[model samples]
Target: MNSRNDRTDLVDTWNGKVEEWPKVRFGDVCEIVARQVDPKLDQYAKLPHISGVNIESGTGRLLFLNTAAEDKVTSNKYLFYSGDVLYSKLRPYLRKALAVDFQGVCSADMYPLRVDRDYLDPEFTAWLLISDSFTKYADGESRRARMPKLNREQLFNWTAQIPPLSKQKTINSYIKWQFDKYIRSRMAAKAQLEAAETLPAAYLRSIFQGPEAESWLILPLGEAGEISSGITLGRRVSDRETRPVPYLRVANVKDGHLDLSDVNEIDATEAEIEKLRLKSGDLLLTEGGDADKLGRGTFWEGQIPDCIHQNHIFRIRFDPSRFCHRFVAAQIASPYGKAYFLAHAKQTTGIATINQKVLSAFPLMVPPVREQKRIALMLDARRTEAERVHSALADRLKAIERLPASILSRAFIGAR
Candidate 1:
């Protein structure tokens, strides 16, 4: 269908009655302020600078403010007065818009719109820009092949339903009340999720710091297991005519568990597969990726027969007579292990890498075999409980995130 028809269908489906209020072009009710000033200039160096990065999505809250003096902002920025509405022109799909209570200099990628107070309220217009309907409109118009952006011409030409000033105030008040409730619920869910995430780390820390830990012998990982790098892919594939065999990458290893959901295949001979293949009790650790992922790993249970791992992952075959794989894996995935990895890892940009020498040198606290088993079992149970709580809180947070648009859809349709 045509663009006009598509827009009408969207409005009717979302708001039910398009003719309930007078329709006006966005520009008719709001004046785009393009006043430019160099933020680094002496006159404006101390003023707060807003950018697309500074505003949180959906919520009109400013995340943090940076002055040109502090941030060393060198570019010309758009000047916005108090009460103006700030709309992000870059990445319109983010739906970032806010009504400011203070004067600031914003990045040129943002449009500081001053609404005609006689016709439209700034708060109401800010809400509309963040609503799903306007977001959809902006997304449609900003459909460039690459780096999609909402241009001033298209944004100004967009039409919106304008209710009476008194009605606008009432609707905005109702939306604010509902949104405040949603924000509180979201914050609580997020806090619970954070707590759940840290529980395992805390538990592990307490165990290591306990009085019993003093009796434990400290040894290097090389003393506990045979640490070896995995198969180098291209050489093995070319060495002989080989068939595709399931193999593990760094992605397959996670903290305390494996995610074999997207395991891939490689070509290798029978001898190569046997040499590099994973066993039921092998501990798999990643060499590098993000700083947090350094040395993170889990035990392998022979989930797939003849499964071998890539070079980026280190395979540790523990001596069953001396060490328990589960206990070692848990200790390596603990906060203590994380701190060691972060300190010793070779960092480039944001990525961190641990070489074979570093992995072999890992300091392991070894207890008696029976005590090791017990500790592993206890940590497993704690991790399971924490994961359950985290998963539930994550689901609640997802629902909370959708609440704002749902409330706005109801409010604009006169359903609330």
Candidate 2:
């Protein structure tokens, strides 16, 4: 079946009547009026300069506009009036086109289209360009180009079903109403997601601060446990026999869990591997990179057998009889531990790092093993609930994003 004929027939059947509205070539109703001007000229230097990046895809929304002088634009641009529609010719699949309310100079990558008042409305034309039918046709034509650009000839030859002027205005109004609803829903979902993200920090602060923490036994980390650095990379060991072994990097360690997704292998002798191999319930902490990432780490569960870590990461093996690894990991991730690390960390430029001496001196608040297990269990339950809410909110935000294109398809293309 011919897809072009099928699209035309589908449009005709919208009202259960054949040929309810006349179809017309886009160029017949709108003219690409060129008024190219040098942006460096005194008259155009201060005007807001728009490019393809300025227009939001599938929603006719113009983002933060910058003046030609501020951007230091040195090329010739298409001069557009307040009522003109700016259509991006590059990457037709992005569906970037919008109606401007103020005069501006835009990059030549876009066309400044002026709709004939008697035949078409500017708002309706802007919406139609981002409609599903028009976008599909434009993408098909531009797909053959090396850079996926719609040439002038292909753009003008595009056809769409057009109703009378009054009907066109009604359709535009309906689309605008739907857009308002979509924006409100999106804003509410984003607010909920932001609130959910702050729960982790709050949970940590509640347990590690106040008079309750003062009653617990406090001990230095070096006296309570053993801390050792991992294998160093890029070292010469030609005389010694070596075998490839999987090792963790600083990137593999997260605040509360390990992301073993992209683990890499390094060449190390059997003796080096035996010394640095990871054990279940052992805590792994990073040296430091950014100020925020200082001493960030989580407990290892031995997910990858015989896996060792790089030198940038430190392994802490706590005494199993006295300390619960989960409870200790919870302390280090808390704001109290963060404050200690930040105060003792050596700063070079913007990056903060902690030496073995600083890490060994970390004051760990210790409770009975049974009490430690209870605290760890409570924190884990709260964290799990927060993550579940976060995941749900993120999925809702993604669904809300698809509303604009769906609304346009229903308004202009008669798509259900």
- Best candidate, lDDT-wise? 2
Question: For every model shown, what is its TM-score relative to the native structure?
Answer: 0.82, 0.91
The TM-score leader among the candidates is 2
lDDT of 2 by residue, 320-396 (tens): 88999999999998999999999999999999999888999999999898899999999999999999999999999
TM-score of 1: 0.82
RMSD (Cα, Å) of model 1: 6.9
TM-score of 2: 0.91
RMSD of candidates 1 onward, in order:
6.9, 5.4
